[model samples]
Target chain A: MADAAAAPNADQYEEQHVHEVYEQIASHFSSTRYQAWPIVKSFMQELEPGTIGLDVGCGNGKYLAVNKDVFIVGSDRSSNLVKIAAQHEPHSAIIADSLVLPHQPGRFDFAICIAVIHHLSTPQRRQEAVKVILECLRDDGRALIYVWALEQKNSRRGWDEGDDQDVMVPWVLKTGKKNPMEDGATEKTFQRYYHLYRSGELEADVNAVGGGVVDSGYEKDNWWAICCKSESFTKASG
Target chain B: MKVLTLNFLTCAVKACKSTSTSFPLHPKDCEMVSDTIEPNPKLLYNILPRVNWTALLTTVAELGFPELPPNPPTIEELQADEKMTQELHTLLLETQISEGCLVCGNCGHAYAIKEGIANFLLPNHLV
Candidate 1:
């Protein structure tokens, strides 16, 4: 908490830890993320055939292939990931930041932000990211957001309630070749900042962003919420 | 980026959000390609309503494509006319912007496009 509070250059911090790391390990990370989560699959499959939506923080564009009928514009901070995502025909991918998406406000039919908010090293930045996602939706449009959970004692990480939420998770990159002239494989570990949401913390952030949570639940060691723009926020802003 | 995607994008700068000229970013020195995308009339009919026709017109004209009708054809009209469906498909889904820079009228910020992906990452000063 003390270290996170001192992060005056949160953008620069994320640039080093989050953005740069993804740029380096995009292909390796994408190889491990091909399968879409069950809840996310169902949520996307349920959309109307002609619906238009966004996949914010869309790594490798895995979800872009989920449903071919709908058009999805996938965006990622890493250009390497966007390059892979652009291969999903009929849908498009572009390099963009979630906090400052190039999309128009309240125009999209729907949006999905999966496993993205946790990377923000600060609570205020997390809520600000949520606010931007909400701002992209139409009055009746909905956005599904997912984040890492603190209460995942059963998982490999073994984190649970009452633990420090702000933590650095390690991503190990194994590189080398199996050749007579070369040495054995070497490993490099990169630390990524994550803010694990405890119990109702995700809902609280949504409410703080003036978004209404329609449905929320825990799935596979992560917390997920489906939300929409609040009527009051719309009325107040308009 | 597809011409369809350009229709939905604008300047990422926060100050440009409220400006009227921000939507429909103007493409400069664009290298375009047309892939033979399988036609989907149902998708086009559904997408037609949500699209900003005026903004799309601006993008099409800026890219040097033949002028489209002033207004978007209704879904009924699109469905009945196969040629219109093919034309719309060619314009929206097939045409790709492989290389270019999109300039914002609001802030004069130019976002570079390469390998069919547009980079919207603003410089630190701009951010």
Candidate 2:
């Protein structure tokens, strides 16, 4: 993928590099993302019973089953992913874009947009994504967000600070079939666009969208933040 | 999509969010299914307060279900009445739209439902 700032057609670029890739690898991707991150699990567990929330970009809905007492409506751009997610009982999943969610504004108790905003092709789009999430929240509603960290030198990708923030990460899908012309199984590589958030970047985006970061920390290879709409923004909109 | 989920959803169009008509999208030519889900009164009681009664009434009436009371039942009333609890549990959770369209009252944009999952993705012009 090209630099985020240089992409002239951000939506089209994302439609190809982000949306289409996820549509193709939804099942394979869902199988590998079954493990729940500790912070996200704790965030879901801490919510009060009867609270309603949205899981923006809920792939496979692994988190939807974490807490049965509360209800969560999960949405994903990929129908295949939403299909897998909809199977989680006591919760629901629908095919929806995070940027244009189908829910009414300022009604949710909480929301979690994990590893989804980074798929947006530009900083503006990323912040807009955050803005949309914040808009869905009530006055006291808080949202937790996670993005791939640029400071993951210890991880396999070794994306250090100052590296190109926007890059294409390849996901290799192994089709279990003996290739007639080759010696190994058939495989396909899909390149997915990601904007690696540098240290303090996630918080900055939240603030840029008039959201206040309640708490933030680095966990695993991702930067996570819990945020709420700023008082002024909420008042102005409400 | 479950009937309860539809209560929270509206037209995905940005312009439709501000309109009163968009909330509780109207189901058209919907094929309904009733799943044998275990009844949970606590969940139903907790969820009742959040549901917009007027919109839910409109939804049920459109779906050919019997008309509900003028107002939602109090949590205490719901807790005491087993039949009401079961009925609400059935209406909100068990009942789902298997296939059809959810047309937005404001924009008249119909989102398709297939295999119990509603596609809320709008066309490029709508977005």
Estimate every model's Cα lDDT from 0 to 1. 0.88, 0.89
Interface DockQ per candidate: 0.86, 0.82
**Fnat, 2 decimals, each candidate:** 0.79, 0.72
Predicted model with the maximum DockQ? 1
- In candidate 1, which residue ranges exceed 4 Å CA deviation? A178-185, A231-238
How do the residues B48-105 of candidate 1 rate in per-residue lDDT, one tens digit apiece?
8889999999898888889999998998888789998999999999999898899999
State the weakest 10-residue window (summed lDDT) of model 1 chain A.
Answer: A176-185
